[model samples]
Target chain A: MKGITVRSPARAAELFHALADPTRLEILDELKEGECCVCELTDRLQAGQSRLSFHLKVLKGAGMIVDRREGRWMYYSVNAEALAELDDLVDSLKQAKRARRATGCC
Target chain B: MKGITVRSPARAAELFHALADPTRLEILDELKEGECCVCELTDRLQAGQSRLSFHLKVLKGAGMIVDRREGRWMYYSVNAEALAELDDLVDSLKQAKRARRATGCC
Candidate 1:
């Protein structure tokens, strides 16, 4: 389960850090099913407008979520391919961990 | 080339933080080819013993790299499965980015 986790350590680290915060993770979850406007996200998320915006900004910065402006409203979507890749990557880690000798060093 | 990247934003952020530091990134790069002992890593890395240990600890904490202690010496190897998963995830991102509409945001 260790070592053989993610390819491109830098890339992995970048991706990991992008979702480091709970708020950001929450935003991704909200968008998992489909795109939603800011109002919809706030109503469903039940968070302050400013706080939600901040989280959205972070997610967007990381390229984990994309938003489009249709007039004053912004619609957000789950980057489905990204999510699929993530599961597969983790699955790969699970497989590698089985073959690898689990080291004690942590 | 934006708003479509790594899956499991949380996982991605974790992996990103693991390699966030230059030292950690360098350590990862060194391990890219194969595993190495602390001494070998130190000699090749030309970094302080304490610093190297700290970096190794961070990488280990994030499951980016693994080490096996054969006596007092520890051999570290890149988790191949993890590496493959990381690339595939990125490729997935590339695909999503290409298909998704580019949106302008702060």
Candidate 2:
């Protein structure tokens, strides 16, 4: 809850669900290089504007990315803070798994 | 590819999709304790046998768990190897995302 130590199965499911689409994953890939407007992303991804926007909304809603308006274009970038917390969660999971193994729980 | 450095959007999507459901996440949580049979899990989770089996199938198909037959009961445990790779993938993503930010790509 505080930093990647996910105790709620529902929350874990929601977070993972946000990353469960190919198109959305591709959008994240594009954003990996930097922030970009929807137009540039649409052009680079060669995806329809509407579909791209939908995926963007999913990622944004999940707190994976953030958007800023600059004149006519809205630029989107990965929410580094949010993503860092996700990374921390993964680390905690790994540790938990190891602890389980050590205790011969499974 | 070799470890958790995921290069394919499609593969990442597939892996994440396998973990997107609350039931599946619950199953993973149950397995975190150790190997369990369908009956034990169903009793603990208060879910129906058919639905639990379906979730188990999904987890197994994703290489996240393995099943074994022991006389009359079938047992399952987390595929620690696969899960470890997934953890590694998360680590790599964190590094990649950080690298992108440092270079002011976004």
Candidate 3:
């Protein structure tokens, strides 16, 4: 996975670290529908305001999602570009595995 | 991510958790080359035998890799089927994102 020089293991680790939490993943699932304000997300997820806010911060910090403020409402949505990067990284690993198989490394 | 009902968040969380550590990721990288005994992995990773063993156990627990023993040597390799399942999950998320965009979820 590393010898392919695709990306550093640290970056992959960071991305996975961000994704390790069930709550955070649930938050991402909600955002996948569309951008939504914190209040809406809190209501939909039935999570405490503080708890939802904490998870939102983690997702944002990992660049997995982005936020915008309109008036007093802060809206969040999936950061598609970031997710695409992660997708490509996983694909690279998969492709590498296939290549190894073709080379009879099984 | 979840509304699609393809897989549970807990399962996704478990997979991501297994990938969260840099050392574990490095161990996976080494295994990508093909099956290797723990001693060879330790030398390649330049990690203490016990430490490497610990990470290998974690990876195996998460179903990301499998181990086999021949005589006194234990060998580890990536679980290609499991990794393929992970690949499909990620691809589903990415496709869902694209579909959302097209559906005017932006």
Categorize the docking of model 3: acceptable
Using alpha carbons, what is the TM-score of model 2? 0.83
Local distance difference test, per candidate?
0.64, 0.74, 0.77
Off by over 4 Å in 3: A1-3, A97-106, B1-3, B97-106
| Per-model TM against the reference | 0.58, 0.83, 0.85
lDDT tens readout by residue for model 3, B34-97? 7778887777778998999889888998899998888788878889887887886676555454
The runs of at least 3 residues in candidate 1 whose Cα sits more than 4 Å from the true structure, single-residue gaps closed, are A1-15, A78-106, B1-16, B79-106
lDDT of 2 by residue, A47-93 (tens): 99999989999888878889999887888987887677666555545
Calculate the i-RMS of every candidate, to one decimal place.
8.1, 4.3, 4.6
Two-way TM-score contest, 1 vs 2, winner: 2
Candidate 3 lDDT tens digits, A1-106: 3456337888888888888888888888777767778887777778999999998898898888899988888889889888887887676555454233433221
As for lDDT, the candidate ahead, 2 or 3, is 3
What ranking emerges by lDDT with the best candidate at the front?
3, 2, 1
